[model samples]
Target: MITRRAAFCLPALLALPARAADWPLRPVRIIVPFAAGGPADGLARMLAEVFAPRLGQPVVVENRAGAGGIIGTGAAAAAADGHTLLFGSVSMTIVPHLQAQPVPYDVVRDFVPLGLVGSTPFVAVVPASSPIRDVAGLVAAAKAGPRAITAANSGNGTLSHLATELFNARTGTAIESVAYRGEGVLMPDLLNGTVALGFLTLSTVLPHIRAGRLRALAVAGPARLAGLPETPTFAEADVAGLEVDGWQALLAPRATPAASVERMAALLQEAMADPALRERIAGFGVLPASADRAAFAALFPEEFRRWGDLVRSRGIRAE
Candidate 1:
């Protein structure tokens, strides 16, 4: 017999299949909350190319750069279409804590982490001519004089900035951080030997390192990079709490359907598994670290707390 409850439940059961089938009915937009030509934008475009055919729809890359990625991230959080996703970076975890103003979206509440694209290690670099050949040398220099060694970073609250702070806290050095608008501005000073040291991503500093303009002292990761085999990791250098990577991930609005998130996760897994794709990402100096939805979900909150604690303890602020 069809009871009153069964009658109402029947419609919802029928709708589930329809919702799953109708997903990706239109173009999927991946919002990159940074200026074009940066790593996040490049990654978004690459993912778009791979996701389009798999999702049976065009995956459009949108740049909504402003307020240090808040504008686009907020837009992605508010989107209910399920077709719109966010290509977020470690900044997503760090920025909210650093901002003086209230953030529009909550990392844990407003979004679901669909997948982790990968992470790239930051390198501790000095000008090619600097005598500081390794982390220990740099530390000794910093201890010689307070704020004597100027440590430059791309911006305040960035991974580079936080890493520099962590370095100071862990090693008991007072290397002052000088924040710049972007890497473009920071690199020039770094190359000119104006800044004593920098904590920058491999991609941003790789060209300089390869061109003999910058020297890599250490990599902030668990293991030494294959390309920079000679460089030791922070842990290897006996510097703990500095082993963090600048990671990117795909996230959807929290209200997005479970089926759609699962499908997106599968497509991302397939894309990351492709040898050609992995090679391409590596060419850009990013290691492919694609994880399933569950893994990413677990990783996101931990990162959020980790960065938050760092920011608060250091009193790091964003301009």
Candidate 2:
């Protein structure tokens, strides 16, 4: 009788949806919670270019920028259709905790993690003509004149700003921050010798560094990136607490069909596994990372816990 009951229960359990395939019945939208042309935007476009044809439906990228990406991300979270997905970066994890009120969306409860796309190192850069040539020199200059260094950040409470703040807190130096609408604007000023220094993604700053328009002082990562081997890692510069990476990720609305998430995740993994796609994106200094349904599901809670600690401990507030 026990064996009979077990056999009956097994069939019922196995009858439940297994997420094997048969997803994406129609067109899909990928929301990028920032302006076009940045790292997140580029990543989304690349994925769309590769995913649309394989999925037999068009994939579109929509840019919804504002309020440190809250406006756009909130829109994505509220999307009712599983066909709509969010392509976001560190801000998706950072903003909710840093805001005084609850953010527009709950990072832990409102979205499903698809997986990390990739991460790039953060570069401490200044205008090429600036007097501070390196991390040590910048620290010394800031010490001599407190809040004298004007650093440009695309937004308040962003990874770039947080990285800069972490550095300030560790080194005990004051760096007055200048907020910008976007990196496109900041890069020009950085190239023209307007801002003293700032933390920007390596992929965004790499060309300028090569062009000799901006000076890279250090890279913030676990180890120095292969392309910029000569640049010292933050640890090498003795800049404690100067460890943070810029990342991109994919997210779906909470409770999206498991089958839908699984199918998209599989296609994404296949797309990333393509050698040409990997090579082209890697040339931009961003690596490709993909995860399956179960692993991807675990990312949001972990990121929420980690970033929430940093925001609370550091008292980072949205400006």
Candidate 3:
């Protein structure tokens, strides 16, 4: 003989199993906002390889490159299913402020930061035969006259462009900037001395520097890079308050359950802690610096504000 209260609780108890189903009911999709063969794509694929076995499901990497990561990122933010995730970079913070029209998604509201992948410092490089040997030399030449030094960037409002702008602002020099479609287009001009200097990812220019085609005068980070130990950092070179590092992180749609988010974060943290995995990521030219969900959530707001201020102050606009 069941009491009235027990009868009322039976239906709820019976539904618990269905309500508490494990996440990843199907294959998980990791969206890379940039094109394949880039740093962000590489990171996503590496993460997927580790996540597949941990989550007991397939983890697929999807490249949805367009508009400097806006299209793919917006798609990820709008995804209703928890199965889709985004592998984003610093451009996630920078792109919103760059657009003239209103952006479709909100960085602070539309998605939850799952974990931070890693970061790589940008290296300031010039042709090996160029007369500019260091940051000071570059500054002195730029201050000598208007348009004295021409710097090339991958695109308008890109990390490379902002880095050059930050250098000019901090050092009180006027280095003219030339924008190219992408790094592939900019590399030729940089190597041939058509452009005076450029800030590029360490991985992209490390070979050139080692092969005697380009000279790395300074790196953009708080400390010097291990691969370019001889090169000083921007702060070390007397240009204080000019630190920038290209970082990548994972994000999920806002509607995703907290349990799923936590599970993914735990899995990522465990994978990032593996020494063998760290060595492989380091080989790709980025430092392995993984953060759990809470840390990543705190980091996003700070970075968003910092990049927003820089973009507005420099009057940077999209092309």
Please list all clashing residue pairs in model 2, or write none if there are none: none
Cα shift from native, residue 128, model 1 (Å): 2.6
lDDT (tens digit, per residue) of candidate 3 on 229-314: 99999888988988887888888898777778777778888888998888888878888886577888998988889889989998
Q: lDDT per residue, candidate 2, 117-174, as tens digits?
A: 7777788999888989788998998898868888898877777777777788778887
lDDT of 3: 0.88
Model 1: worst 10 consecutive residues (lDDT sum) = 14-23
Q: Which ten residues in a row have the lowest lDDT in candidate 3?
A: 14-23
Give the residue spans of candidate 2 off by over 4 A: 1-18, 35-39, 63-66, 188-194, 283-285, 290-302, 309-316
Which of the two, 1 or 2, has more lDDT?
1
**Best candidate according to TM-score:** 1
* Model 1 regions lying over 4 Å from their true place: 1-10, 13-22
Q: lDDT (0-100) at residue 144 of candidate 2?
A: 88
lDDT of each: 0.87, 0.80, 0.88
Candidate 2 yields a Cα-based lDDT of 0.80
Better of 1 and 3 by TM-score: 1
Per-candidate total of colliding backbone pairs: 0, 0, 0
